[model samples]
Target: MAQVLEFKLPDLGEGLTEAEIVRWLVAVGDVVAVDQPVVEVETAKAMVEVPCPYGGVVTARYGEEGTELPVGAPLLTVAVGGTGGPGPAPAVEQGAGAAAEPTGTAASAESAVSSEYSGNVLVGYGTAGPAARRRRVRQTAPAATPAPVAAPAPAPAPTRQGPVPVISPLVRKLARDGGLDLRRVRGSGPEGLILRADVELALATARDHREPAPAPVAPAPSVAPAGERVPLRGVRGAVADKLSRSRTEIPDATCWVDADATELMAARAAMNAAGGPKISLLALLARICVHALARFPELNSTVDTAAREIVRLPDVHLGFAAQTPRGLVVPVVKDAGRRTAESLTEEFGRLTEAARQSALTPADLTGGTFTLNNYGVFGVDGSTPIINHPEAAMLGVGRIIPKPWVHRGELAARQVVQLSLTFDHRVCDGGTAGGFLRYVADCVEQPAVLLRTV
Candidate 1:
């Protein structure tokens, strides 16, 4: 008897209802093993590779690359038992084909089929077969008196091996760019073959001793030739869609406030002096925003343009608008509500590094309840920022400037920073938005407010 199995899209993360199919690694009739990568998906934040949970021959593909699929929708089908006919029909038809009957009853079928095979399995899709139910039994027959077995000679000691081999072209290029010796890297790819990830790991390990490369010289500007055109795809296309949707659908309002952050900067400098990573002013500001959002959960929300509903999140996930060479990329930190300031600083460092290298996955880019964009690094004072939709608000931090202020009736120079909050007016009114900004400004002006809340 032949058995068929359907593989549905697994839940990627919180509040993620759907994803775009970026690529498929297998085709019909291709044999696949459990835990082998079968497809790559692009979620709102990053691209992720999903593995097959069953070992079988692929029977059908449910959707094409670039098609958006909802969670729990069948992605592919596989035929087990070697002789099994094509598996269940895909939920979405790509072409004309005879429809297969819906397999056994949902409750009993999954239970009966899943109770069979015993192996390390992926979540949701359990193993199937008689081996899953078999138990080891002890041998009870008396052993015959053994004939004299030949004495085995002592095994030779293994020789010490050098670094693993490099085989990937991408890894080789990365190693060359980083001025690394491929021979010195222990590869992590299949059969010890070096990959781009391994080369990156090697570079990270030797970062302390490696000298930073000089910045690249900019190309000289020239007059446009007769006709020049460039097709927009991939990141460019995604960015244009997101920007247009945010601009048209979300009714945004902006407010600016100034803070004397002399204390916060001093505190950060003191912490760095004690051998900690250099925490930036923007990072401190992010921490404050997260703290304020926790107090006013309404601020950390998204307006559903299609549903005409405001969805408020229980936890805070801070998204940072990182300017990348390709374009603007917003990668979010998951559960900012649960992390400490120090941990947030480390996450910021990791996120920025991943963004710059274009290494962020889709999961890292989605599910943001709030966002922060720092123009301070570029020496900009302040400007109105467009809210990153789904997320009701985005806070912008501007450069710190020395300004005269009255301290106990005496004129004194203080480091002042401009902060702008852009919020979705559809969900938040002026009063709510203003209060949120005022709370954040208070926290920045007096770092002790954070301690009091804790």
Candidate 2:
């Protein structure tokens, strides 16, 4: 007999609780190899494929595309070691709960189960790798005469079971709030799983059966237009929540200054012109930030609100803001204090490309000691952007443009840029913050100032 094994959604790291189904690679009756990606899911952090651990025929899938499932919910079932080619074609049986998922044969699947099972669920630990082209296994129907079409039978009333198959708490809460019995609601999801829609339909039916209420009086019409409503979910939602929390918790202050970045620009140009790999201006700014943080470590620390402590971090994990099609994301460069400008340029390019492609892993996005917002790329002068939460400070760089300046006691057009520092007020006073900003501005004005420390 083919042993059917249920695979629940594995715990994706970094405290993620749920993921939305984006696409399915394997269907019912399709053959899946061990550690092959069976589905693509979008979490708050990134899009990743969930691979199956067993090599067998897929018996059923739990959710449809766009359905959000909790971390420990059953994703699918596979029949291992069945005595048939692939599995039975999809069939809808009365009281089967779901209408489309297929059944499997016992003997052939059993042999397949033993040979192909790897028991590895995550990407890096086992056979799971980066998302690649799915190797589709075509499922063919059994050779049999088809029955004539007839009127569909009415759905049977749901019978009370040992336990309800609802996975999401939101679905349970909806059913509870609506005063609907979950046992009476027939599930349309796989394996007789009670979905939110089922609970909603039951509630709607109950309302329809009740006596109609009297019509309410009309209210005065307003001239205001209902504007577009976009849901803040996934990346956008995460950003909004983090920024809100940062603003609500941290008492922050901003200090800004205009610096003649002519020398910094010249130094970068010289380095790039004579080097094998080009150096980016952002890298130079990051270098300046790192050096400044070294001189004044308070700006590089985060205030532990729970402990009522100011914890200074030893190594700099520099996060630079990058705007993508999804929204704004900050990808952190690890050990930035130890990296050269060329290395920083390379890592920034890698992370920025990953962010643009929506391929950044959770590890690439977290553990930042400080943030660098180069809003200059947006063609703006200056902005006091909100600090990324848990981190004490952010350094904002504005556009470097040619302007009239006194250089070497003569009036000339110099490349001038505005640099702003926003720090948590609890961590340091204005003097420490100003000293850090002054050091950064001095580096921009005279690149030689960085050499003495470097």
The Cα local distance difference test for each model comes to 0.67, 0.77
| Model 2 per-residue lDDT tens digits across residues 293-412 | 999998889988889899999999999999998799999999999999989999999999888766777778888999999999999999998999999999999999999999899999
Best by lDDT: 2
Mark the 10 consecutive residues where model 2 has the least summed lDDT: 144-153
Model 1 stretches astray by more than 4 angstroms:
1-227, 275-278
Instruction: Residues 136-239, candidate 1: write the lDDT tens digits.
Output: 12222222121121222233213327754653344567788988877666543323444454566667657734567867988878877867775344555577
Q: What is the lDDT of residue 205 in candidate 2?
A: 70
Q: After superposition, how far is residue 329 of candidate 2 from its true place, in Å?
A: 1.2
RMSD of 1: 20.9
Best by TM-score: 2
Give candidate 2 regions above 4 Å deviation: 1-6, 26-31, 56-64, 74-96, 99-216, 219-227
